[model samples]
Target: MSAPPRVPRTRPEPVAPDPAVPEPAVPEPTLSELAVSEPAAAEALDAHEEHAWSRCDPWSAALRSGRGPLYLHREDGTRHPLDIERWCAAPDAADRTVIERCRGSVLDIGCGPGRFLVALAERRLTALGIDANPHAVARAVRAGGGALCRSVFAPLPGTGSWHTALLVDGNIGIGGDPPRLLRRTAELVRPGGTLLVETAAHALDERLSVRVGDGRGVHGTAFPWARLGSTALLRHAEETGAWAKAGEWEAGGRRFVALRRA
Candidate 1:
């Protein structure tokens, strides 16, 4: 038989890229191909902080692309459509089950546009979202959803907060420092609280790191800016001493883990 599949030996560590190998030049994407690709993930932030460009710029092109499904927090401050509505609207038994199991307040880390928060609010559960983008926060508020304008690594606005916090859409990348990211998340979660994380496709180094910027910007093996993967996520949980276990959803091509403070 061919060699057995390579199980992860240990969590993959992302060392900084060497200075000798210049960061690749990511070409500005085509403004014309908005229909072909899905949008990339972005934590909400304010307008001025975001770049002003259209289809020609890497960020805007990627945002407008149909490459990956997305929930847009429009630059115009109006509620744009979100591709995640299908799932967020009709949470499967697995997700509903998790919701039913949750106790006390809830928070959605990197809560983009308050989609989850609004859904949870409908369920009559107390919920909030915290994202790095001020523009996103404003849109969320305008959308009549509640969320915080802050980065994941920053301290939460309130203490001894919620019993359950979510990190969905491969959002485990809270600054490319998984261990510290986990520790901070755990701290934000109160005693007996649980952190529910949704992970990206596995064997992360290549498939996940293909973020093409202007080619002049920094390229990272792990996301110091955006989403991240399972290895770094699990490793961070371990390092932070959070009791953790992963649940793989093979049919959906995703995996999620729940970690609780021990």
Candidate 2:
């Protein structure tokens, strides 16, 4: 018999905060401890237990320069351009839709450069942004928004109590496993709280091993990522049984889905 196919290994990026500037303190949970019920996921995570920072240097360069010619280069050679400029800019129409829908305390997961955090603060809403890139966190702080260098799977402050958790800008693909991410988000949100996720405009449910590339041939560390459209997202949410679809809409060519925690 043929050997089983190897599962793609993806270790969480653990970026240390800049020593020049202090960041808020939050306890971190071991990667080994998450999703223990899912043996395959746990095994995959454990496989890379000692890997260091996810070499986001190429991505860091783009954020530091406040622009992008960056793209996600898949193993198959398909490249998806990343909107670094928009993420560095002020919130646009689609972002406004998300900002307006936010309530109570908010957690911006994988918040790149903190545009949404700043927007939320401008409205006087309590918010915090967490990212696994030290550069992104530093940029966010410089932009006058609260941010921490951390992963979503790590233990965060006020776990199980946030009013809203955001997975915008294709962040839902962070772990390359949508169902696992959905389940983790459910742990972070309060009962009946909401999860606002951005999805692809068309039907798409794909997992890819990719690296951040400058489009000039430079690439960063390879990581597993996934993408989901509204249909795929709804299906995963139902399967998790931890979320119920509350609403779905499109603005500025971006699709969003609102999920109420069950």
Candidate 3:
């Protein structure tokens, strides 16, 4: 009887995969890749000097009292008073003179609270300030200036396109290596661009491990810093291969040197 009328056979429904199971794993990063991926962590480890600038309100005495007696202690057992007030103030006559020399787009390295940047903007110049401290950058932006929170050693915007790079307010001490710093600055500016640098009034060239200390026996970690005089800066300019001493001037009892790329 045709097997009692062929029973209709139906195919079984396809089983759906489990949703909770994870997809195939991604290969973990190698050691070198890990190091490269987390560059900010490495930078944070070496940024001991940033403690003061990162945490303290260097502008207001009421705020500074909480982070008191900040001074730069040198390896040679000397100390230099860090004048936070002056750095936070408006550009003085000397600073204005330096600003006048800025011909085109300006990059102010270590631009503390950005008084210079504000001044340049007021004059309708294309200017940008960079500082390692977020607080400083915020203050600058709040004051209607353009600023970025970054170290000069870090990759910057518009490298080799800037017409002027400033190392004012003793920022030449960055990394405590003047020749290296000058070389880097040369790379940042276009050919024939200018670098306006502030130098120590005295004829001294020093590389020191410096730490900030509060008079109340509290101190931050130490980092390399440098101090150079006009003569020493000129020598450094010669060593940097592309820089030449263009001129020198004095402002507000501070000495500055102008270097032009050859």
Candidate 4:
């Protein structure tokens, strides 16, 4: 018989908030409220203070279990499975390609569980993993990688000095505004530094409100996300005037683009 999949022997302890991204003084709606609230109302929450990103939300639970029956349910009734298995596993061939191309101090935005950070550390490379999910950050640290429970829009260490910034694993869709995210990333990367992005497999460019849902029909807060193909990503980069496409390639059926800060 095949060996059973390994599971965590114990529950992860609560993680402390990273000092780098302090909580705001204002009160905010709970994540549960955001789940049933209008998307427009949830959108009003500060990017740095989105409860779904910080609390023990569905994403965090899935990460803790090292598996998933998770899906991103779009407002239009479309659903996309989040590949939690692949995310929790070691870096695959496609991930390796990105790792090889990384240069200088690396910043991994929305780095869930720090698989890349672990891989980068194996190569003795300087890298830091940042995520809003506290559980994911704890997992990354326990796996012997450096991570911070912080959001990209919040204050971060080494602003405008990171040699490379990464947006992979569908993180390009973060906040549902590709152009604005691209522009913000430019501000984080040093002049002439690089931004490596992974795009969708096929031709696609869209922005939509989505929620984290499980097979049991439970749903979490709604948040904005975007999907972009290489063409669309390049176009956004061009429009921002902060990056130029250095190259594009495909591996393991995934497409990626490398952009140099202009």
* Candidate 1 lDDT by residue in tens digits, 56-137: 1333223323232332222233322334444333455555545554444667877655556665666655566765544444
**Candidate 4 residues 1-262, lDDT tens each?**
2211222222222223323332323222221221221112123235534755444256767988888898999888889999888988899999999999886667899888889988876665567776766677678878866666656776566667777799999999987899988998998888878899999988899988888887678777787789999999999999999999999999999999999997
Q: How many backbone clashes does candidate 1 have?
A: 14
TM-score, cand. 1 vs. native = 0.57
- Pairs in steric clash, model 3: none
- Against the hidden true structure, what lDDT does model 3 obtain? 0.67
User: Considering TM-score, which of the candidate structures 1 and 2 is the better prediction for this target?
Assistant: 2
Looking at model 1, which ten-residue stretch has the lowest summed lDDT? 3-12
Q: Local error of candidate 1 at 42, Å?
A: 16
Stretch of 10 with least lDDT, candidate 4: 32-41
Q: Candidate 1: global Cα-lDDT?
A: 0.48
Q: Report model 2's TM-score to 2 decimal places.
A: 0.81
Query: In model 3, where do residues sit more than 4 Å from their true spots?
Result: 1-69
Instruction: Report the C-alpha lDDT of model 2 over 1-262, residue by residue, as the tens digit.
Output: 2212222222222223224322223332232332122222122232222121235567878978988899998898999999999999999988999998987667899898999988887776667777666667668877867665567776566688777899999998987889989999999988878899999989999987888899888887788889999999999999999999999999999999999999
lDDT of 1 at 224: 29
For model 4, name the residue pairs that clash. Answer: none
Compare candidates 3 and 4 on lDDT and give the better one.
4
Model 2: lowest-lDDT 10 consecutive positions: 44-53
Q: Can you write out model 3's per-residue Cα lDDT over 170-257, one digit (the tens) per residue?
A: 8999877888789888877878788999999999998888766655555555667888999999988898789998889997798999
